[model samples]
Target: MASEWVVAKKCLYLHLPLALTSGGSFLYMEQYIVSARKYRPSTFASVVGQQALTGTLKNAIATDRLAHAYLFCGSRGVGKTSCARIFAKTINCTARTPQGEACNQCDSCRQFNENRSMNIIELDAASNNGVDDIRQLVDQVMVPPSVGRYRVFIIDEVHMLSQSAFNAFLKTLEEPPSYVVFILATTEKHKIIPTILSRCQIYDFNRISIADMVKHMQAVAANEGIETEPAALNVIARKADGAMRDALSIFDQVAASSRGKITYQATIENLNVLDQSYYNRLVDAFVAQDVATSLLIYKEIREKGFDSQFFINGLGLYLRDLMVAANPATLTLLEATDDVRQQMAERAAKLHPTFLYKAMSLCNDADFNFRQASNKQFLIELTLIKLCQLLSPSPDESGSDEGQMRPLESFTTSSPAPHPIDIPAPQPAPAAAPTKAPTPAAPAAVHAPVQPVAPPPAATAYSLGGLSLRSRGASAAKAPTEPSPAAPAPVELHRSKPYSDADVERAWGTVRRSFPAEPMLTGIIEAAVPARKDGDSFELAVGTPMQADIVGKQLATINRTLRNLLENDSVELTVAVCEGEIPPAFWTDAQVLDHIVANHPAVGQLINKYKLRLD
Candidate 1:
């Protein structure tokens, strides 16, 4: 007996430790739960950032007004399937309370918790999106629930359902059995056909608010006994963009990266986020018109592995926030911490409204063109330079009027008071004596016979109209001189008579055909009537200064063309603004020119001479 007891003691010592070690390993394994499943909302009340959706579902359950087919559409991770499962449990719970909540103490709820529920079915349509899979689902829908009152079928990613599968499932989806309930969830509702959309009650889920996400994350951190900063959690919440599941996933990543204590710096570094300080400094530089500082901030961000495109896009969004904060009505939309919000408000106040508008426009343009730009860094730098220019006063208006005016020093001064000088008037010179004298025997001979020299035939003067020409010696010697070899014979000059009303009409018709399709010129041409003609010079009356200027500028070109057409180089053109019976095409270049000069003097001056009409 003593020998048996010694052997048993040795065996017990060895076996006891092995059994204890196995139990210790099991205990350690049991301590951890993945953040995803550990934080999944177990009850309707436990869900985060979906109070309205959950409340509506609860009210429906309470009123016993359940739809046969329901559709939930939203971005991913915004509580689609979780709501479906909760709805399934609430409706089929054996011990459902009067308030329409499932009692966890019941056998049916326990089966659901254990993943053994017979009435609820989930199908991932992304992988099983075929006619056969849908047919199988239809077949299952025919069967009654064995353990619950209603059979719930949850189809996830319902948008992925094949066209044939959707068609095959449509009849049953529209008219399922009284005991059947179908819940479809998808991120893209547009992909789902209109027929399918028409048969279901759609619920659109919104992105979770940052405050709500942070509150839930804080609750999670508290439950896990992890330390976190509110600022750090706020960053994670914003990064999640309104999806609670995404927030929790990010929380897990950040918590792991930080070894359970998340600081703002750790969160930013782990996420590879450009620091807010950089954005703040950039904005400060923009406010102060500091291009060098803005460029330096951009360089630092680039060095930190942030893409220039993303940096520009983020800067655009930041400016947009500043714009929103500039107004009290839009301040609510700015999603930042209180401290950051106050800083934005202060910065917004310092910026001019027009400057902000122009800055925002520049940033947005840079973001849009960043992708196509060959030298993207230059594009960003140019955008900063433009933003800086916006803050400075325009060069045209930067100085006072007095500073722009010409100074007295620029004027040329006259030489000091020139003295008067005395001068004498010149006397006329005496006439010279004749070189030869003739002796006459009789008075008739001395007087040279006193015979009148008849004027030459070429020297005889005749006037055709207002113009006349005479030979050079005709006035002095009263006789024509022989034509010189070097000089051509002079032709008589004649004045042109003024055109009659009929003649004026004929000339305007000629002008009209000259400019067939130019409306402004055509209109003016049609409105013009000959006012007067003086010695080959014609004048046309226009109703306004604009028309006068137009015709006046075109006068030279028109005159040249008219002279070539009419074989008359002496023809001249004149335009004058007058008050008279306005023609049908009464708008003259004068009125148009006046308007153009009024609105755009530079354009007017570039195109034609402008004269302001005085009323």
Candidate 2:
């Protein structure tokens, strides 16, 4: 099928007339032209999304600084070969424009445009990629152009040439005749040998942006007498994924399907894309913490025959776009049409930035584990459930605890209600105590009731990683589910109960799990052999001050966890060096390997028997 498409595309570009047998007569039909070939750039100024490259080529031509060999590198349909053809024609034209474009009226330009010039050659290196082909090309280089000043040889898909073929062509490419200009084009630039790369002046082409693609498609539609909605064009542009040729092809496809009147609904249906409404609805469900609604939305999308992985990936991208749209500075990065962008912007305004970040993170994780998941739907559903939970407020005890999660700051609406708990006014500060690192003073006793102080009526909503799903209307029946803040209290260190060795051990074990990313720190915590002292402070025994320093940096979080787990508010942590206890960094790579081997002798035996080299 791919070969057939290639053959058909070649036939189209070649414009081979078809012979049709009419009644008692033979007739030749005009060749059919695809949009890609029909709208292919004829001049440097006509290329899309490659201004820098076009400018450089034009400048080089104007300045008369052409190189013997040139390499145009980029993905398909970014106009590498088109530019090469344009450049070749421009350089050979007898009457060129001031902007360095070829004059179509010139005999040389006319002949090249009509595919009758012998000055240019195009070789498909994918098929003719052997040393003999390179030798043939080298032989052709010795012959001067019959009509133009320079003989231009364009090699398409040049990376397919074998190493031996590349080597065979290297000498000719490096020192071609003055009249010969070699132009190499390839989608995979990295596969070309470095020797070939060094010989050519390489120009990298960028992918066409969605905006550029839309603008170009609009022009194409207008010329073709087709009517299209901006939203429909935007969908086509995105579906093209940065290839102008692809965008034009899709434009043609969509144009045919819509019968010259394209709409967004028609596009999504034809493309088999999940509806945009799913994203909007799911986002609302996420903000509301409505798990049931979110799950139902997933079911509807799944019923539409969309792949779970594809849907989840799209959801991740949607969340990312929301994150980008949430900030004014990054709004320019949102690639949708104005109406779609405006809708996204409104959703972004209501969404807390942290919530978007976490939501995106959850979706990204699910996407990463999608292939390994035992139940794909369950994985997707679990991700949605987690996203919904992010909007719910966590308990003050759990939320305030070290390593515990809290709902992201809420910004769902204009006005946010205050928490239900009555927050007492702060008391005046007492004079500082003489002791070092003196503890905060305990609050004075309060017998009277405190009132819940609300934020100003005009104030915006704010919560922790997610929004409070409070009722938008001013109705008392609909209650917000946010947890209350803790009462103002201070610790009395003197009245604190002492923790036991067993309690310390248990607390240490539980606290260390919080730093799974830092296994080294976990190991240090275990090796330190912390012992309880008579004072509030507990000491960690280690070999060096460096280990102590490492532990000290994380001391605050560690102390908080210990204090919570041990049920004591007055827990202090410090490190004391004991030289022989822990080795600093396990000395070297070999020593580290030895330690691993010591833990499991079978691994060491396997290493020795296999004669493994780590590098």
lDDT of each: 0.65, 0.68
lDDT of 2 by residue, 204-318 (tens): 9998888888888888889888888888888888888888999888887877788878788888888887777899899888866678999999999999899999999999999
Please give the range of 10 consecutive residues that has the lowest summed lDDT in model 1. 405-414
Model 2 / residue 538 / CA error / Å? 36
Give the Cα-based TM-score of candidate 2 against the true structure: 0.63
Instruction: Give the candidate number with the greatest TM-score.
Output: 2
Model 1, 344-372: lDDT tens digits are 88777655455566678898999889889
| Runs of candidate 1 exceeding 4 Å displacement | 1-31, 97-99, 336-343, 395-615
What clash count goes with each model?
A: 8, 10
lDDT of 2: 0.68
Model 2: weakest 10-residue lDDT segment is 444-453
